[model samples]
Each structure stands twice: as C-alpha cells, then as structure tokens.
Target: MITLTLVGIGSGNPEHLTLQAVRALNDADLILIPEKGKAKDELAQVRREICANVLTSDVHIQGFDLPIRNEAITDYDARVNDWHDRIAVIWKQQIDAHLPDGGKVAFLVWGDPSLYDSTLRIADRIQANMPLDVKVIPGITSIQTLTAAHAIPVNTINGPFVVTTGRRLRDEGLPAGIENVIVMLDGECSFTGLNPDGLHIYWTAYAGMEGEINLSGPLSEITDEIIATRKAAREDRGWVMDIYMLVRSTP
Candidate 1:
C-alpha cells in the first residue's frame, strides 16, 4: 500500500509552512517534485528549497516531468481529463520506481490542495488503480496572503463575496449578488474585462515571494499601469504568478 501525503507548502514562502506540514515533510521517505519543463523549473526549485530547510529525515527527492496541458485540443474538459490521467500515470510510475515496497511518499503542493487545485483529483485516480491511502497537510493560500498584504478583510459588512479564477471572471462577468471577488489562476489580467467605473482593484504579483508587487486604486486610474507593469514583470521573470481582488460598492 502506498501512503501518499499531499503537503501544501504555501505561496513559496517558508514562513507560511505550517507545523503539521513541516512534520509531514520530515516523515516522508520519498518526495516527488514535478518539473513543469525548463521554463517553470522555479516551481520545482521552490519544493527543493522547502525540503532542504524543513526535512529532518533522509528523504530521497526525485524530479518527474509534469505532463503538459493540451491547449490545442480545443475541448477544455476533455483536455484537462486527459492531462489528469497522464499525471496519474506519471505519479504511479515514479512511486513504483522509487519505493517498490510502499513507503511514505509526499508531493509539495502550491497553495492549499482543497482550493482550486487538481492534485487531490489526480491522487484519487492513483488510488483507483493501486492500493493507496492519502492525506493532506494544509498550507497558507495565495488568497490569504493577498488579503493580508492589502490589510483588508475579504468582504464588506454583511456582504457576499466570491473566489474564482481569472478566466471565470472574464468569461462570466461579475458574479451575481457579490460586491467583492478574489481572482486567482490568471495569466491575463481578467480585471481589464470589467467596466472600470466604480471598481476598486487590489493586485499583487508573487504575493509571498521576494520582489512582490502590489498595485491598487480605482480600476480606471491604475488599469493601464497594472497591465504594463504586469507585462513587464512577466517578461523579466520569464514566468509570473499573480492574484487580485476587485471590490465594487453597492451603488
């Protein structure tokens, strides 16, 4: 039986790691780090760095190439389903190769696994094919970090809020009956799709990492600046992870 621990490492900040997560890291016999190809190796590096700092056991670290999501497939749901299956196979292959006897294996997840992440789903797929037990160690999310950095509560007094992705916000427009929206998993500035009038935007790139950028003001005033800055930052870093919140007052 394979005991899989999906450990949340938080937003690339060692300070955000929970005590439980640290313990899980130390207890694991083998850790799998997914390489999102060479361009996104920084992600794998973060896991390596985190393990280096917190791991107390003689845990073996292994890097596996992550399956690329097929954007050219045109069918979004089918594409994702296929990708998840591919990832599950890769995980099984790595686990079988490293720990033939079945030991404590871990994966460093970005953000809390329960929130808008597919790691759990992939794990479920793995469990379907093999005898496995799964556990998750929670970590601080970019949403929490974003709100904390802005020093504001997520919602207004007696008001509703929605947490969604950039694509959802852009495609669906502002959700009904909610004045505040926290958007993540966005490569494009989904905020630009909205009517800039009467909207207050708070944007943060690399929320917990070094060289973090925070920009806020009326959407109309700072929209262009945010776009230009976001573009320049992505070009400079070759990759960028960002989240933002938009709050509109009840008029």
Candidate 2:
C-alpha cells in the first residue's frame, strides 16, 4: 500500500510550517510539487524553499503541471469534477513512473486540505485506481493569517461566524442573522453588494508573506480602495489570493 501523505505547508511563509510538517517532509520517499505555470510559479517556488530549509533526508522531488479547469463548462460542479478526474490521472501516472513498487509519497498542500481545498477529493479519485492510505497534516489557514495580521478576533464574544466562498457570498449575499462572515476564493469583491452601513471589513492579500497587504475599515468607506488595491496587486504579482472578514453590528 502506498502511503499518501498530504502535508499542509501553511500560507506563504516558511515559518508557518509546523514541526509536524517539517517531519513529514523529511520522511517522504518522494515529494510531488504541482506546477501552476509561470503565472503562479512563486507558489511552487515557496514549496521548494520550504523543502530546502527542512528536508535533511535525501528524497526524490518531482514537479508536475497542474491541470487547468475547463471554464467553458457552465455547470460549476461538472467542471470541477472533470478537472479533478484529469488531475487524478496525472498523479497516478507520476507515482507509477517514479515508484513502481510503491512507497511513501507526499504532496505539499497550501493551507489545510480540509478547508476549501480539493486535494482530498482528488485523492479519493486516486484511491479508486490503486491501493492507498491517506494521511492529512493540518496547517494554519488563510483565515487565521488574515485575523492575525489584522489583529482582530474572528468572532465577537459569545457569537458565531460563517466561512464561505465567493460564489456563495455573491449568490446568497450575507446570511441573515450571522454577524461574522469570512469569505474565501473570492476573485470578485462580493462585499460591495452588501449594505455597508454597519459592516466592518478586515481584508488581507498574501497574508503571512513578505509582500502582504491589509486594509480594514467600514465597508462603505473602503470597498473601492480594496478593489483597486486588489487589482493592482494581482497585476504586479501575476496572481493574488485574498480573504476577508465582514462583521455586521447587532442591533
């Protein structure tokens, strides 16, 4: 049986890597890094830097091109499922070619795999084709980094918060009774559509990295600033990952 370990490398900072993540890196027989092309090459580069810093054992490292999801398909679920299927095939081919007899293989995942990441789903697809044992190592999430960078609590005292994606936030708007909403995977600034009177936003892009940017204020006052800053950051870096928390005051 092949031991498939998914190690969460945390956000962009190498210091964000936990002791367990470092140990996992040293123990892997082979580590697979996904290349997301030139546009996002820094992401893959960060993983390499982490390995270089922590890896003492001589382990084989391989880089594979991450398959791009088809945007032509109108059905979101169908598009994602098809993309995951293709990724699984590529993963299997790499494993077979490198370790024909089966051994411990690991993949470095950004943030925790359980949160908004499809690595677990894609791994399930791989299990259907081969004997596999999956293990997950959790790391600091973007929400954690965002909150820490902004020096604010995620939820108010004796209150709750909802974590959701950009698409859901846009389609559903802010949930009716919830005071705190953490939005991720939001390429579009969905907060602009909400009634910004009583809402405060804490936004961060590239949290924990050297070039991290943060902005927080009443949503009404900074919505345009956030949009312009986000656009400029994306243009300068070739890609951008951001998360924001919205807190609406209780009447």
TM-score of each: 0.96, 0.97
Model 1: lDDT equals 0.89
Query: 216-243, model 1: which lDDT tens digit per residue?
Result: 8899899999999988988898878899
CA RMSD of all predictions = 1.5, 1.4
Tens digits of per-residue lDDT, candidate 2, 91-124, equal 9999999989989999998889999998999999
Q: Give lDDT per model, in order.
A: 0.89, 0.91
Instruction: Evaluate model 2: give its TM-score.
Output: 0.97
Worst 10 residues of 1 by lDDT: 35-44
**Least well predicted 10-residue stretch by lDDT in candidate 2:** 35-44
Quote the lDDT for 124 in model 2.
Answer: 99
- For lDDT, the strongest prediction is 2
In model 2, the runs with Cα more than 4 Å from the true position are none
Model 2 steric clash total:
0
